[model samples]
Target: MPSSTSRRTVIKTGAVFLALGVTSCTGVPAPSPSSPSTSTPSAGDGPSAAFTFGTASQPLGLDPALSSDVESYRITRQILEGLVGVDQTTGKPTPLLATEWTESDEGRSYTFKLRSGVIFHDGTPFNADAVCANFNRWFAFPAALRQQAPGSSFKGVFKAHSDEASLSIFKSCTAVSADTVRIDLTQRFTAFLQALTLPAFAMASPAALAAGTADVLNQVRGGQPLSAFATNPVGTGPFSLGTWDDASVTLVSNKDYWGERGQIATINFLTYDHPQTRLQALLDGKIDGFDAVTVGNFDQLVKRGMQIVQRDPFSVMYVGINQEVPVLQDVKVRQAIEMAIDKDTLIRKFFIDNTAQASQFVPPKISGFNNEAPSLGHDPAKAKTYLEESGYNGEELKFYYPLNATRPYLPTPEKVYAEISRQLTAVGLNIKPVPVDWSDGYLQKVQSPGDHALHLLGWNGAYADADNFVGPLFGEKNGEFGYQDPQVFSKINRARSMPQGQERDEQYHTINVQIAASVPAVPIAFPISALALSDRVANYPASPVLNEVFTKVQLKP
Candidate 1:
C-alpha cells in the first residue's frame, strides 16, 4: 500500500524520516510492461560476473508455494514468474505472464489474455491450458501436502482448497482458448490482483512437477523441509537455479529470457546470520550488498561511504497474544499487556530513526488506517489495576523470541524482548522467556500450536492492499493467534468482496477498531528497514515488500 521515492520526512529523534504517498488503486490493470533488455552482454551467463548478497538465514524451501520467509522468496522471485507484477513506484499490480486482464461477473470472475510464445524453463508451452494446470494443482493439493507445507500462500489468499472446497473462494479454472484463460471465484476479493503479486503464486513448470515428484516431501536441505521438485523448480523467469550448498545459493541468468538481462550474469545470496558478520563480509569484499541494516551498522555504513537505502515502514512488529492460553482468555489481562508496553521507549532504543509506534496491524500509509483507533497507551498504574482485576494469582506465560536473528521489522530480537519483558513484569505479570535460535525452527515453534503465550513476530505487507495486511493474519482462526472471533471473521469476509470505495474504507476502519479493542494481539511498532551496499553497485531495487529481483541490480564499472 506504500510507495516511497526521493521524498523524505524529518524525524525529531534517531530515526530517518519518510513521507508516504500511498496509491488507492492497487488492483487496476496496468499496461503491457516493456520486457527488460533482451540482448545478452559480451560476457555470457557465468559465475565469474556474480554479485553476492548477504542474507540473514537460508531459505526454508525453493518452492515459493510452500515458503513465505523473505530468504526463500528472495531466491524464488528470480526463478518464478507470476501472472501479475508489482509497480515499484505505486505498489500496484502490473502485468507479468498475462499481458492484460479483465474482471467480470461482479468481480467474481477474471479473464486473462496469455502472453504468446512464452515457454517454461523446461521447454513447455505457457498457454491457457498451462494456466489452468497451475491453478488446478493449487486447488487440488492433497491433505498431506498441505500439512507438510504449512505456510501455503494459496490457502492464505484463496481461503481454502479441495479439502474444504465449500469454504474456498476458488470455484473453477477454464481454458477459454489457446491464448485466453478464465478463473471463477465464489466471492469477490477486492485485492485479488494485488495478492497475485506474491511469489507464492508464481507459476512452476508442469512437466518438471510430474517428473520430479513435487508432492513428495522426501528431501531436506539446510534443516528445511522440501520436495524433489522444489529443489529443481522450473519457471519462465530471468534466472535459473545454479547451485545450492553450504556456502551460498547461486543463480545463472536465463539466456532465453524474454526481457532485460541487465549487466548481472549470475547472482549469489550468501548466508550471514548476524548483522556484524554481514557488515564484515561486505567490508572484506566477500559480498556486494546486504539487507536488514541495524542501528549499530547504519552509522558505520554511512561513514565508510557505503550506500544505504532506507525503505518506508511497510511492516508491523507485534506482541502476539494467543487466546488459547487460559490466562490470556481474560480481556483485562490482554488490556494490561497492551498498556504495559512503552512503544516509544522501544522505538528509541532498538529501532532505527523515524520508526513510528503502531496501534493497529495496518500501516498508517494504507488507506484503511483508522485515525480514531483507540490505543491502551503506556500506563503502568492502569496496567496494574487491570491485572489485579483479572485475577489475584499470576500464571506464568511463556514469551517466545528469536535469538541470533535480525529481521526488517524486529532488528534486535533479544534486546527488544528484554525491554518488553521488563515492562510486563513491572505490571505484575509473570513472564517466562523462551529464547530459540532462528535457524532452529523458531518460526515453526512460535507460529504453530505450542506453549508460547506471547511471541515477537511481525507481518511485512506484500502488496498495496488492506486485505494483504489483515486477511492472512487475522481472517480466520489459525495456530499463530488461536483467535476465533466469528463476528470479526464474518465482517472481514464480507469486506473482501466489496468494491473499492468509501464504503470499503469505512468497513476496514471499523474492522481495525474492532481488532484493536479486542486485543487479539498488541500492535507495537512500524519499523523503517534499510539495506547496505558496497561502492561497486550503482543501483539496487530496494522494495518495502522485499519484492527485489536480482536482475535489476546495476553495477558500476
Candidate 2:
C-alpha cells in the first residue's frame, strides 16, 4: 500500500481540486467541535473507564511494510510513530520522532536529528540506528512490498549504494552520529520529507526484531514464519497493542510515551461483518465509535443522538475496462459504457446524497483539478448508436466485483454491476456479473487481464498531487487491471519531471483531458467519509488520509 503521505502528494500533482459547481444540501458541512451533551453519558459524569470502538471490516494485515489496507494502517498509526507527524491545529506535517531535519543543496540527501529519550513499546532505545534499520529492511523487500496496491512508489524514493572496495552491497544503513543519520536518495524528490511520515517508513526496535529471528522487522508474506512481536507491537506511540481477537483489537496506554498521554487508559477496536451490525452495536452502546455509517441508517443514527463526522474522502470509485478484451478495445464501446450508466440517479437513490457525482477520473478534493474538462453525460441513444457503429453485436461481457467489500457511502459493487448490466443490455450488449471474495478476488481476477473484461475498483488520492491520479492508473508498469496507455505514460513522466508551478499544472491538465477521452475507467461517484463517535471521546480530528493520531484524543473523565 502506498503511504498516506505519498497519496496526498500524488493528489496535489494529478487530481487538482474543482469548484464543485453543483449545489446540493448533501455536501460536507463545516467542521465543528464534538458535542458536549447527548443521550450518552459524559466521561466525567460516569466512571473513568475504558472505551471500545467498532468498524464494519477487519484489518487486512498487521505488518506495516507489507500491508496497505486502511484498517491496518489505522491500527498501526496508534502503535507506531513516524519521523514527522501532522500538526494538531492545521493537520500539516510537523516534526515527531525526528526533532528537525535539513536538506542538502541539491535536495538529494537529508540529515535528521532524532528526539532524545524516546523508547519503543518494549522499552528499547529509539535512535538514529533504529531509523536506519527500518528503512534498510523496507528497501530490501521492495518487490514483496510493492505487491500491495499503490506501493510501487517505494522503489522510486529509496536507493542502495555499494562500496567498490569490498564489492558488496550494503543492506543495513549506518548512522552518521548518535543523534544524526544521513539518507541518500537516487534522485531529488520534492516530497521526500513528507514520505518519511508514512507508516511503512516507521522505525521499529532492533531488540524485538532480533528476538523474533526475522530478517526484517515486520514482514507479511505467505509461507514465512509469522513475526512473534506483531501480535504485541512495541513502538513510541501513545498506545501499545494489548489483545487481538479475530473480530476486534485492544490497546493499552503506553505510560512512557514521549508525547501527551491519552486520557483513556484503554481503547478497543471492534469489528462487524456488516454495516447494519456495526450500526446496531453503536446504538446499543456495544461500541463507542464507528465509521462509514450506512446511508440507510444515517437518519436513525442521527435521531439516536449520534454525532456524524462527514468529509469528502480522497478516493474516487469507478469501473475499470480491460483494454485487452476485444469488445472493450474499441473506443466507441468504452464510450458506450461511460454514457449508458446514470451517475446522478445512482448517487441520489442508492447513496442518498452521501456521494458526489464524479465528472472526471479524479475527485474535487485534490489540488490543481481541472474544472473545465468536459464530462461524458448520460445518453442512452448515443450509446446505442456507438455500439452499432463500433460493430458490437450483443457480445457477452464479463464484469467482476468483490462480493464481501461493500461500504455504505458508495453503491454496493453488485448493485452497481447490476445497474451497468441493465443499462448496457438496452444498448445490445450481454453483460455477466462475476462476484468473488474481497481478499483474492481483487488481485487475481480484476487486476489480472486474463480473468475478466471489466472490474470495479476505487482510487484514493495517495497525495494531493495530480501525478497520483494519473501515474498509477495510466503508467505503463501499472499492472493493476493491466492498463497500459503510452500517451498517458508520457504525460505522467513529463508532469513528474517538471518543477512545481504552472508548467506542471498545465501538463497534468492535458493528462486529465486525454484520460477522459480514452475512457479506460468510467468515473462513478466520490463518496464521503462518515464517522460516529461517542460523547466520551474528545478531540478526534478528521483527516482524508486516515492518519488518526491518538495522542490528542481525550476521555471526558
> What are the Cα lDDT values of the candidates?
0.83, 0.62
lDDT by residue for model 2 (150-203), tens? 332343333222322131112335598877787865445444554555676667
For residues 2-27, could you state the per-residue lDDT of candidate 1 as single tens digits?
11221132112111111232343433
lDDT of 1 at 441: 74
Colliding residue pairs in candidate 1: 1-464, 14-353, 15-353, 15-354, 16-353, 36-259, 36-260, 37-260
List, in order, the clash count of every candidate structure. 8, 29
In candidate 1, which residue ranges exceed 4 Å CA deviation?
1-29, 33-48
Q: Where does candidate 1 have its weakest 10-residue lDDT segment?
A: 10-19
TM-score, cand. 2: 0.81
lDDT of 2 at 96: 74
Instruction: Give, for candidate 2, the lowest lDDT window spanning 10 residues.
Output: 21-30
